[model samples]
Target: MSSAPTPAPGTSTYRERLVPGPAGVAAVVLFAVMCGLVVLVSSTVAAAITSLTVLVVGLVLVAVTSPVVEVRGRELHAGRAHIPVDLLGETEVLDADGVRTALGPGYDPRSFACLRTWTKGAVTARVLDPADPTPSWLVSTRRPAALRAAIEAARGA
Candidate 1:
């Protein structure tokens, strides 16, 4: 396996990029077909163009919306929200079962979640923002333990 990339000097950074899984990718095809169908009965060329446009736009939307959880310097970044490291409370690494529960009945509607259907493990970071709607951040990752450790290490640093 390739080694982990080094973080920049004078700073500690742990970053994990989430990619679209096979199941999630199915939506792109569905979108393309739906767009093409709207024009297919009229003209094949129009259908083809619409399909291409929808596919490209759908892919870009998916790509842009994909989550990236990162701990850099004194901040924790989950999606578009960033909070200070000091404000972060205890972080727990969720196992497969734990992940399921967290995503299921135990899930809080107001909490921030960067979940992936493929990844079976996740790390939850307690948010200290009492005034904010989100209580914590549940970030999906293939290496849950490593992600947890990195957050701890960064916080300690």
Candidate 2:
């Protein structure tokens, strides 16, 4: 198996934004509208204000709660979890079909996956550490090629 390459100290190689989809935003808005409708039976201005407040807060929450994926220094960070680049073996950039398969039929129970429904692209990296139970990492990303390139460059460093 190929081993991970060392990276320069304190350098960030990659960062992938996990934005919520249009459907998700729409759902939030729908919920806010429903809330406003319920309050509409009372006051118009108050209902409008409530709906706007809920919409803004809901959107902010969605953005804030979205998991971040980044390759910083020698580690690959996904959400709240991270692993040393030296423990990663091979990195592969995955398209939509590959992502579906990787998350479906080809999935391993022990592998770590940071999936987002909004993203169709992903990156898979083999975990080389014998001591760790996780076999690999399959993380959803908007920029699959860039993520793969970052991991490869960090590993090669």
Which candidate achieves the best lDDT against the true structure?
Answer: 2
- Model 2, span 1-157: residue lDDT tens: 6665656778888987697888989999999999899899899998999899999999999989999999987788999999987798888898899988887876899999999988989889899989999999999999988887787778674
lDDT of 1 by residue, 50-70 (tens): 999989888888889887877
Clashes of 1: 0
Query: How many pairs collide in each candidate, listed in order?
Result: 0, 1
Model 1, position 105, has a per-residue lDDT of 79
Worst 10 residues of 2 by lDDT: 1-10
- The pairs that clash in candidate 2 are 5-155
RMSD of each: 5.0, 3.1
- After superposition, candidate 2 runs with Cα above 4 Å error: 1-8
- Cα deviation at 67, candidate 1, in Å, is 2.5
